[model samples]
Target: MKIELSGDTFYPVGALENFLPQIGRVVELGDLPIAVFRTSDGRIFAALNQNPHPKGGPLAEGIVSGHYLYDPLYDWKIDLTTGLVQAPDTGRVTMFPVKVEEGQVFIAAAVLQQA
Candidate 1:
């Protein structure tokens, strides 16, 4: 979680509902491939998510369960809260900061771009 001040950086603000609940997808904010999703409560988050290994499947394509998602690529279950790969504690994804505004989703652009 490295955050630094930059003048060229921009944050995104949008409605959480626009993202749709119970569904997940990979979004590219500038240059980052973020796995964006809304919890059962409609809260959204953006993270540096990807499936480990070249299984020809995306981690974002898995079914999100609570804070984890079942990676369809190799049937591996991942915990989103920690971004840790289950069955082994050595794997994790880089998660970014996300904030919600008045009916919108806000994200740190420079960070996403770097991811």
Candidate 2:
């Protein structure tokens, strides 16, 4: 399911039902690795697979609690929606827009612009 909107292309990553709640999956857009997460409430979020922390942990391996992801290496709390490293922690991960249509998951090509 590919969608073209105003010159931006949305590439289908996988089926929505395949994204388990509180789990993160890695999808590659060209050379970029994106971490896609699904909350318990069925909301989808996408972010760069790399954590913002100096150690640069793999966000896909992080623990998801609600909309926040706790970095598996540093335990840094990051908001999945905004990619903000919650309080006390500083730095942010790049985030991409995600859309689910008819049970298919799509991630926008805007990430290429960011790259």
Candidate 3:
């Protein structure tokens, strides 16, 4: 399903309950690969599936702790909410706005245009 808000389009990825807590799953947004994560506390987040490190890795395979994702390849800490690599690391992943409604998960299309 698709929802339009203020000219931004939100595309539904899946049901919120389908996502396991602390586990990341890759979903395709057009041609873009997005890493969708549900935190232990039930918060949902979405970001580009590619890690920001020079030696790239799959973000979906990374470990999620709280709101941070530890890169599977280099163990770099990345904030799932802001996409910022924590201090001592330098790089940023592209994050997409996520919304949960009626048990459904949606990701914004605006961020995809910027990516």
The prediction achieving the highest TM-score against the true structure is 3
Which residue window of length 10 is worst by lDDT in model 1? 1-10
Candidate 3 structure quality by residue, lDDT tens digits, 1-115: 1222234679999999889999999999887888999999999999878887887878998899999998879989998888899999998888788899999999888533331
Question: Residue 20: error of model 3 in Å?
Answer: 0.5
User: Over 4 Å off in model 3, which ranges?
Assistant: 1-7
Residues 21-57 of candidate 2 have per-residue lDDT tens digits of 9999999977778899999889999887887777776
**Segments of candidate 2 deviating more than 4 angstroms:** 1-7, 111-115
Best lDDT among the predictions, by candidate number? 3
Ranking of predictions according to TM-score: 3, 2, 1
**Ranking 2 against 3 by TM-score, winner:** 3
Q: What C-alpha lDDT, on a 0 to 100 scale, does residue 73 get in candidate 2?
A: 89
Cα deviation of 93, candidate 1, in Å:
1.3
lDDT of 2: 0.83
TM-score of structure candidate 2:
0.88
Using Cα atoms with residue i matched to residue i, what is each candidate's TM-score against the true structure? 0.73, 0.88, 0.89
Go through the candidates in order and give each one's C-alpha lDDT.
Answer: 0.63, 0.83, 0.85
- lDDT-based ranking: 3, 2, 1
